[model samples]
Target: MASLTCRADCTHPANHRHLRFVWLYFTTVNLSALDLNLLLVFHTVLEEKTVAKAAAKLHVTPPAISNSLSRLRAVIGDPLLVRRGRGLVPTPRAQELAPRVATALRELERAVGDDRTFDPATTRRRFVLACSDNDQIASVPHLAATLASEMPLAQLHIVSIDQLKASDGLAAGIVDAAVVPTAASHADVHAEPLYVDHGVLVLRKGHPIRAPRLSRAQFNSLRYVDTWIVLGRAGVGTKMMDAFLHRHGLVRNVAVIVPGFAAAAMIVATTDLAVGMPMRVAVQLAKHLPLRVAKIPAPAMPIEMQLVWHARTHEDPGAKLFRALVADAFRDKPRR
Candidate 1:
């Protein structure tokens, strides 16, 4: 084979195109002969900046990591990493290749590692979920119990994240999935309707509000407790209720604002303040507290809770299993 080379000043379009082809061909040839696992070692060593640290991370011996580094250097024809006083530093070429190699390794792992059959009873995978306070109240208990019984070894971490940042967190791999009222519009985020719940009025068990319903006048006159979190500005229920009330020329007296739905529920259960929240959430809270659930006087606002995840993990077995578990746990059932 003739040696392929490109001049610095190859101004001709055809020459530029040929140069690109040659570069791609050489890259493919280089990668075809390289061991994919070596890339993992290379990335670890670059990240850790020492063979000993990389060995510890990969659960291998330092000599093995050094040998792998030698092989990588020979194959790539570059001193990928160089030793300084006590640490190693990546060369210019290694620095340039680091991100691409890391990305490729992550993608490869996601493609192969997660495609295996999921065995919930045996696997020790951990799944992180981003949920609101309401989701924590309504869904977490059931989910925790179900997972504890069905997947004893698996772990679950529920985190409170801003709803608006849910998509960003999923995309960035901060959380595996998010339980939100509305789906995000990001192209890389995937959303599924988990369940549809409606807003209801919550008050103390023997408060003034009666069963079945409360008149619009009574509803407007009662003091209200609002749950205001950092992301409360984008609350779907609040926005919808405001719009509905605006249309009817009515507004509830928001006498108090609490940090979360749990707190609001607690306040409403013992005081004259009443809260409007999802029926499922209110019902769950009422089970533990002296609270009563009643129909919202205004037109009903259906809160469609959704499960959102990144497209990158769409096919990941663990992610898929967790998504299925959440959907099954929260799936709406007919009233008996």
Candidate 2:
């Protein structure tokens, strides 16, 4: 891995000819000898146009920039830049490569910015995300719909994880982001508050609970369908449900305990069992689904949803864009 990283001087007409010979040798001979470092220089020169300006930006001497240009011409097998008046004008090949060159540099910039942060609009990137099935039913859909309008090129791959394995997906880079209910205590990961959703009771449009007076006693006596996992709590929803029942001095006879919210909602809507779920999700899906959400009179149990990513992908443009869009959609008020 020895690299002819950079060179700093080229003046004589004969040296230009020699650089041309190097270019011919690369094209007519082996391409592997072509130096990757020269591409960086070519990108700088392409952006700057002037050798002195590119050198100044790269923190190198003007001759170094020229030598880099010479190497670039050799490796690319093109007179990529031709002197025109006081500046260098790109040849056809250089013109063809400008966009690709710029994109490469931008990727490098992002990688350096924050283990490679991302931008959304201009980035044609795909990100993998692991979330519970409940997220697919709730958090992910709203964000995906928003992104479809704002960033059509940005694609999200959603993987369902029921057993709570947030760290593995992130560490393996298989999942760029994870929307988990619990906060990440891992030092290597970055987690931020996406939003907090309070639990709500979902009943049919004409259910008895929708009456003007809803009582805790009526709630406890009714058969209840519950999910095993509460977004933020461990031991699932059992402990949290117990705490709520304790406040009422009554315990809910659990008719069924399912693995996810969608299931609970499905079971509750068709049957007499009352289902407790995140308020926002219940409300959002209410119009389409045959369900209505009612406020629980006891203490409000809010579940905190967080966005987690490895420290590596925090600064990626696409990741940052998706994160911002998710946050904005879930915020107390939508900005737009």
lDDT winner: 1
Reference-based lDDT, residue 194, model 1: 83
* Ten-residue region with minimum lDDT total, candidate 2: 1-10
Position 30, candidate 2: lDDT: 53
Clashes of 1: 0
| Deviating ranges (above 4 Å) for candidate 1 | 1-115, 163-167, 229-239, 334-336
- Top TM-score model: 1
lDDT of residue 78 for candidate 2: 87
Instruction: Give the least accurate 10-residue stretch of model 1, judged by summed lDDT.
Output: 1-10
Off by over 4 Å in 2: 1-124, 161-167, 182-184, 230-235
lDDT of each: 0.74, 0.67
- Candidate 2 residue-wise lDDT, 246-322, digit = tens: 87675678889887777787777788788777777787668677888877667677778777877656766676777
lDDT of 1: 0.74
